[model samples]
Target: MSRIAESFKNGKAFIGFVTGGDPSLEKSEEFILEMVRGGADLVEIGIPFSDPIAEGVVIQEANIRALSAGATVDKIFDLVASLRKRTEVPLVFLTYLNPVFNYGFSRFFQRCADLGVDGIIIPDLPYEEKGELAEIAAGFGVDVISLIAPTSEQRIKQIAQEATGFIYVVSSMGVTGMRSEIQTDLKAILEVVKGVSSIPTAVGFGINTPKQAGEIAKITDGVIVGSAIVKIIEKHGENAGPYIYDYVQSMKNAVKELD
Candidate 1:
């Protein structure tokens, strides 16, 4: 099984996300390791972009912080290279398409393959346009994960059928951030995906708290927590490691209870 697929086999996966070079690349590495230590089955490293259209204020500010701190595509690649020496936990990139195109798809995916990145999640890349990188990425054994939003009613089946790795089910209609409640009919959307594909599905966007995680885990194969963790890092800055570890441990335990 692919590393991404293997992550879901153990039970409901708890996927954690943090911006690469937020505060600093060293700190980013530290936080990622802490997430793994706390029980993240998979991790997504955001390659900071100037205009992260899919991000809310929390992550948008994180992008700015990372960029101001001199986060570069090459630097992020080096960060992943360093991370591979320490852990084998699945690492995925949550990035926009411009950076990948600017870095050159073949070179980018080659680096990912060499550095042990399991998959990638591109928010703005439409399912129809995924061919722009999907073929190249697959050549290097990298799965181009597909995102199915609440608005993607008819397209959910089509996206699921072609998706590699796992499908990211957006829990609401808006961008990424924590919400008081996810009002989408996620169970129905997941039902469509399951009908067409057996690939694991993880619900993200606005998911925070163990109660929310456990509730979502009962319906999906996994739960992805990004903004909530980013908020923790934002509040603590360089000293966010222990806080991250504790928070992730609680979130992971929440998901683990389903097993």
Candidate 2:
């Protein structure tokens, strides 16, 4: 089984996310390592893009911060290689279609395999359009993860059928940001997804607190947290490690308590 799938086997996976170079590569590495140590079964690192269509202001600003710090695809790949030597946790890249295309699909997926990245998430790559790189990704042993939004009612089953790594269930209709509450009919959505695919499903978007994580865990295999963690790094910079550990630990604890 792929490492990402293996994570869900233990319990509800706590997937932590942070833009690779939010402030600096060194700081990013430090904080992300803390997240792993704290109980992140899997982690998604953003490859900062100028126009993150699926992202809200929090992640959009994080992209700017990373870019300003000299973040590049090549640089992020190197960082992942370095990080791989230290941790066995599954690492997935959260990026856009443009960057992967600009880098060349075959080349990008090859680089991910070389660097130990297990999966890739291109939010803008629709289910119908995923064929653009899905074949190439599989050739390199890198799974192309699918994102199913609330609007994707009929398509959820189709997506789950061919899903490779895991299904990223987008909890809200809008972009990535912490919301006061998740208003989507995810319970019904998940029922369809679970009925069709055996692959694990993890909900992302608008999850910030442990309460949110615990609540969502009841329906899905995991929680993907982005904005909240990135916001912490944006405020704390290099000293964000301890805070990341605490937050991830709490979220993990919440999931465990549900069990």
Candidate 3:
């Protein structure tokens, strides 16, 4: 079974996140390897953008550093292609709609297919605006994962119905970052997602600890931790892999509690 599906069947969903050119492409590769070994069922590699308005300070800085280091969309694809040699765990590309458009949707999805990417997550692509890209992705057998915010209810159903693979349930109303606690009623939110999506539902945003991951896993298919992992990369530099491995292992152990 694919690691993602297997995790869901085992009553636990894997945590995944977008790691842009933060430390460096080479270092990020090692970090991804560690994530898999540390029990990540999937990995979302972020293609750095110049105007990352949806990210927090930490992530924005990481993106800049990545861009400054010459991390291009093409380079990101090459890294993803190389990753295919190491594992079968699903790899999802996370980016803004602009870059996808610039690269040409049909060609991008086709290349992603060739590279064995399981999915794509375009944060700015609304369900109402995804007609062309969605059609092309479906034709290429690439899953188009969609997101739902705290305020979205009716729209959530539409996104879930049209979305492939697992749905990314944004745990907060704000942009991506670490938080003290996700103040929203995630249980109610998950129920809304469950009502529309036959696919698994994974919660993200503001999750930073195993305790939080365990709490969310009780009612959802998975948990996604981002800024927390990025911060580890920031602090440990080249040692990011070991730090991520340790954190992910802790989250994995916590999620296992639900099983």
Candidate 4:
């Protein structure tokens, strides 16, 4: 089974996100191992880009730092290639569509397949325009994951049904960041998702605390934490790995409470 699918099988999946080449590629690699060791069921590596519209200030700065530090598409691929030798955790690229277009879609997916990447989450690519990537991804064994917003009331059924690996259920409306409280009707949103398909759903955006993760875990298949992690990297730099390891473990423990 695909590592992503396998994660859902195990229980509440704790998906961790980190920008590739944040402080440095070597540090990013260390962070990935720490995340896995801390019990992250899946990891989303942010491919640094010049403009990340879906991200809030935390991740936008992370992108800038990574890009400034010379994190290129080839370099990120090489990083993952080396990582594949040591671990088989589900690795998904959380990137914008422009990078893929510039790199040549076919070649990008080809390299991903060769390097054992399990799936991809392009926040900019809406469902209507996913056909192009989906067609190529199918041939290369990569899942072009889909996202369902809280406001996607009308299109939730359609989006949920066609989601490949898992559905990324956006917890709030704005760009990705940590929040004090998520006031959206997530239970109602998840209802539409569950009614439509069996594909697992993971909620992201504004999930910083263990209590928050546990509450979301009650309804979704997994919990995705991003900006909170980036803050750790920003504060600790190369030494953030150990702190991230403990943070991820705490989050994972929170999700385990769902059982």
Over 4 Å off, model 3: 1-7
lDDT (C-alpha, whole model) for all candidates = 0.96, 0.91, 0.83, 0.94
Per residue, candidate 4 scores C-alpha lDDT tens digits across 8-94 of: 998899999999999999999999999999999999999999989999999999999999999999999999998999899999999
- For model 3, state the Cα shift of residue 40 in Å: 0.6
Q: Which stretches of candidate 1 lie above 4 Å from their native place?
A: none
Cα displacement (Å) at residue 223, model 4: 0.1
What digit string (tens of lDDT, one per residue) describes model 2 on residues 122-200?
Answer: 9888789888699999999998998889888778889889999999999998788989999899999999998988889
Clashing residue pairs found in predicted model 2:
none
lDDT of 3 by residue, 105-222 (tens): 8889999889887788888887787888888998998888888888787687777777678888888887899988878888887787788767888999889988889988898888
- Candidates sorted by lDDT, best first: 1, 4, 2, 3
Please provide TM-scores, in order, for all candidate models, with all chains considered together: 0.99, 0.98, 0.96, 0.99
Instruction: Give the Å shift of residue 112 in candidate 4.
Output: 0.5
Colliding residue pairs in candidate 1: none
Check candidate 4 and list the clashing pairs. Answer: none
Candidate 2 ranges with C-alpha deviation above 4 Å: none
Pairwise TM-score winner, candidates 1 and 3: 1
lDDT of 4 at 74: 96
By lDDT, the best candidate is 1
